[model samples]
Target: MSMQTSIALGKQYLLDTYAQVPVVFAGGEGMYLIDEEGKKYLDFVGGIAVNALGYHDAGLSAAIAEVVEKGLLHCSNLYYNTQAIAAAKGLCTLAGMDRVFFCNSGAEANEAALKLARKFGHKSNPARTDIISMVHSFHGRTYGAITATGQDKYHVNFDPLPQGFSYAKFNNLESVKALVNEKTCAIIVEPIQGEGGIVPATVEFLQGLRELCDQKDILLIYDEVQCGMGRSGKPFAYQVYGVKPDILTTAKALAGGIPAGAMLTCEKANEIFKPGDHASTFGGNALAMAGVNEMVRRLNDPEFTDAVQQMGSYLREKLVQLAALYPTLCGEVRGMGLINGMVLTVSPRKVVDACFERGLLVASAGYDVLRFVPPLIVRQQDIDKALAIVEQALASLL
Candidate 1:
C-alpha cells in the first residue's frame, strides 16, 4: 500500500493521540528501517527503545517462529507454560529478584508495581497508601501510573486523579524527605529519566533514598521501563549504582520487541501479592516468553554488555563533539549508555524533522532535548553515521 493511502486510512480510523512522523515502515534490517517507498532510514529511536536487538534478529526471529509453529500462543495464567517458566527464571537470575509478574506494556508493569506497593503498605497500616514520585518523571498513561507521574501537563484535563500521590524534586533528597510521613507507602524513581530529558539520578540521591526507605519501612521502586535490559550497560539500571530497590518495573525492550512487561520484586515485596491480588491475561503468553528467553540469554553475556558499554562511550564522545561544534544550537549533554539526550537551544522538533527528512529517525524528550536510544546492537560505525546526520540536522537549523 502507498504511504499516503495508509496514513489517510489511519487518520480516518485511528485515535488522534500521537503526532506521528510521515513515514510508514515496511521492514527493517539490523539498524535501518525501510519505508513503504523503499527508503532506508537509520533508526536511532529504536521504536522508543523497544527494539533492543534491532530488526530481523536471527535468534529472536527463530525463537518467535518456533513458538508460532507450536500453535499455543497463550495458555493464560490458569496453567503454567514452560516458556514463561524459563523466561521468568532467566529474568529473576539476571535481576536478582525473587519473583516476577508479567504484563503487556510498561504502563501495565507500572500499574502492577503500584498495586503491589499499596497492598504491601496496607498490610502494615491502611493509611500508608501514598506513593512519592520524582518531579518531571513519566510513568505511564493509566490512572494509577499517570497519577504517580510528577508532571502536571500529563495530569491536566484528567481531573480527580487518584489521591495520595505527590511529587518530589528530581535529585533533591530534601524534597523527598519532607514528603515522607506515616501515609507514604513507597517511592518510585527512574535511575535515568528517559522522557524527562535523559537526566541521570545522582549517586548520592539514589543511595540516600535507599537508606531513607530502609529506615522508614517504605518500598523503593525503580522504573526501568526505558533504561533496563542492558540499556544502561548493565542488566538493570540499579546495578550501575549498586543500590537495589525492593521493586523494579521493566518493559519496552524486555521481550525483544514483543509486547511484554514485568514487575520484579525482592524477597520481602514478593510475598505481598497473593495469587488473587493481581493478574494479567496476556502477561506471559508463550509467544512473548519465547522472545524474552532469547533476549535474556543474549543480555546475560558479559561480552555483549561490555560491547554496549564501549559503544555507549563512543556515542557519548561523538555527541559531546557535536554539542561543541554547534555551541549556539546545543547545551548540556546528558545520559548514560545509549539512552542519551542533548539539550537543544533551537526547537528540538525542527531538528528531529530535519533528520527525518535526511533518512534518520530520532525523537525529542520534553521540549528542548533531543533523545537518542538506538538498538543495543548498534555499532561504532552506526553511531558515526547517525551523528553525521545529526550534525547535518543541526547545521540546517543554524
Candidate 2:
C-alpha cells in the first residue's frame, strides 16, 4: 500500500543491478515527481536523460492515449504502421540520412550499428570486421555494445566478448588513427561523450575522423544515444561538429519516456541489412511510435529547441558561478547544451546523494562528474531551483 512496501516487492523481483535511491514516484508533472507521501522532487536528472520532454507531458500523453484508444500496442514488425513509418521518416529527414531502423533502447541501437558495420565489412572484405571504439564511451550493456564499450567496469565479468573490438583514446585523433588498419570496419564515437564525464569531442577530432573514414573507405558511426533529439539544443550533436557519419544511432530521448531506439544511415550503407539480416520482435510497434512521433515533432520545433539552447546556457552559467563558490570541491563545468556536467574535485556519489536528500535528482558519469540531462521542456526558473539545491549540496560537502 505504501512506497516502501512497493519498493520491497520490486527488489525481490528485479535484478540487483542498479543502486537505486530510496524514493518512489506516484506520478510526475513537468520536471517534478511526487512520492506516495505526496512529497515532490525536482527531477533534473530526467530519468537519467531519457525523459526529454519530462514526465507525463501533455503532447506525449495525448499521443499514447490516442494510439491505445486505437487498439494497437504490439503490432509487431510485420504489418507496417503509419506511426512508425512517420517517425522513421521524420528522424531521417531531420538527420539528413536515408534510412532508419527502430529498436528499443540506446544500447540496442548501438548494437544494431555494430552489426550493420560488421555485415557491411564482411560483405566487402569478409575479413575486415574489426571496430575501433573510444575508451570511456558507454555504448550499452548488450553483448555487442558491451564489447564495443571501452570501459573496464562493464567489461569485467563479461569475458570472451565478441572479437574484432578494440579501444582508442578519447578526443585524441592520433589514437584513433593508430588503430585503424585493413581490418577496421568502422570507428564508432559519441559526438559529445555523455556518460564519459560529459566530454564533448573536439571539432578537429571529429572532422579528422570523418576524413580518415573517407580515405579508408570505412563507415563512420555516431552514437548520439544521450546527446540527440534536442538534448544538445541541436537535432543531433553531429550537426555541431560539421562531420557526418555513415551510420548514426539514437535512442534515449526518442520516445520521451517511452522505450524506443533508432539507427539511421546513408543510402549506400543502408543496403547492408538484407530482408532477414536483423529484426526485433517489438521494434517499431504502433504504440511506441505514437510516443516517438510526438517527442520528435515537439523537439524538432525551432521554438522548443531554441529554448533548450537558451536554457542550457542559462543553467551552465549558474553552474559556473556556483562552482566558483566552492573552488576546492568543485572543478570546471564541461559539455554542450543541456547535457552538461559539474566537474567535482571530490567524490560524485556523495554529491549525488546529497542532492537526492535535498529533493533534487542528479546523475553521475564515470566517477567524479555530476551530469544534468534534464527535460528540454524544463524552464529557466526550474533550473534555478535545481541549481539552488546543487549549491546547497556543495556547500554542505565542506
Candidate 3:
C-alpha cells in the first residue's frame, strides 16, 4: 500500500490524537526499519525507548513463536500461567524485591503503584493520602499518572484531577522537605528525568529522600518506568545511586518490545494486599510473560549489562568530542546510560526532521534537547554511523 493511502485511511478512521510524521515503517530488523517501498532507515528512537533489543531480535521472536505455538495469549486472572509466575519471579530476583504485579504498560504499572501506595498509607493511617512528585517529571498519560506528572502542560487540559497530589523542585532537597507532611503517602520520582531534558537527580538528593522516607514513615516510590530494564546500564537505575524505593514501577523494555510492565516492592510493602486488594484484567498474560521472561533473563546477565554501560560511556564520550568540535549546535550531553540527550540552542525538532530525511530515526525530548535512546544492543560501529548522520544534520543547522 502507498504511504498516502495508509495516512488517509488513518486520518479517516483513527482519532486525531498524534502528530505523526510522514514515514510509515513496513518492517524492522535488528536496528533498522524499512518503509513500505523498501527504504531502510537506521532507528535510534527505538519506538520512543520502548523497543529495547531493537526490532525482530532472534530470542524475542523465538519466545513469541513458542508462546504462540502453545495457543495461549490472554489467560484470564483465574488460573496461574507458567509465563506469569516465572516472569514475576525473575523480576523479583533481579530487583531484589519481595513481589511483583505485572501489567501491560508503563502507565498501568504506575497506576498500580499509586493504588498500592494509597492503600498502604491508609492502612497505616487513614488520613495519610497526599503524594509528592518532582516538577517536570513525566510519569505517563493516564488520569492518575497525568496528575502525578509535575509538568503543567499535561495538567492544563485535565482539571478536577485527583486530589492529594503535590509537586516539588527537582535536584533540590529543601523543596522536597517543604512538600512532605503528615498526609503525604508517597513521593514518586524518576532518578534521571527522561522527558524533562534528560536531567539526573543528585546522589545526595536521592540518598536524602531515602533517609527522609525512612524517618517520616512514608513510602518512597521510584518511577523507573523509563529508566529501568537495562536502559540505565543496570537492571534498575536506583541501584546506581545506592538507593532503594519502597515501590519501584518499571515498563518500557521490560519485555523488549512486548507490552509488559511490573510493580515491585519490599517485603513489608508487599503485605499491603492480602488475597486480592488489586488486580489487572490483562496484567500478566501468557504471551506477554513469555516475552518478558526472555527479556528479564537476557538483562539479568552481567556481561550484557556491562556492555550497555560501556556503550553508554562510548556514546557520551563521542558526544563530548563532537561538542568540542561544534559548540554551536551541541551544547552538552547528559544521562546515566544509553539514555542520553544532546542539548542545543537550535531547534531539535528541525534536527530530528533533518535526520529523518537522511534515514536516521531519532526523537526530541524538549525544544532544544535532541535525545538519543538507541537500542541497548546497538553496536559501537552503529553508534559511529549514527553520530555521522547527526553530525551532518547538525552541521546544516550551523
Q: TM-score for all predictions? A: 0.99, 0.98, 0.98
Per-residue lDDT of 29-140 in model 3, one digit per residue for the tens?
A: 9889998789999988998778888888999999999999988887788889999999989989898788998888988889989988899889878999899999999999
* 2 or 3, greater by lDDT: 2
Best by TM-score: 1
Rank by TM-score, highest first.
1, 2, 3
Where does model 3 exceed 4 Å of error?
A: none
Off by over 4 Å in 1: none
- From the highest lDDT down, the ranking of the candidates is 1, 2, 3
- For residues 1-398, could you state the per-residue lDDT of candidate 2 as single tens digits? 98899899889998998898877788898889889889999988888788888887888889999988988787777789889889988888888899999999989999899999999899879999999999999899999999899899998987989999999998899999999999999999999888889999999999999999999889999999999988888888888778899999999888887898999999668889988889998889888889888977886688988898899899989999998989999998988888999889889999999999999989899888999988888898898899999889988989
lDDT of 1 by residue, 1-398 (tens): 78999989889998999998878889999999999999999999999999999999999999999999988899989999999999999999999998999999999999999999999899999989999999999999999999988888999999999989999999999999999999999999999998988999999999999999999999999999999999999989899999999999999999989999999999679889987999999999999999899989999899888888899889988899999999999999988888899999888999999999999999999888999999999998899999999999999888
Q: Worst 10-residue stretch by lDDT in candidate 2?
A: 70-79
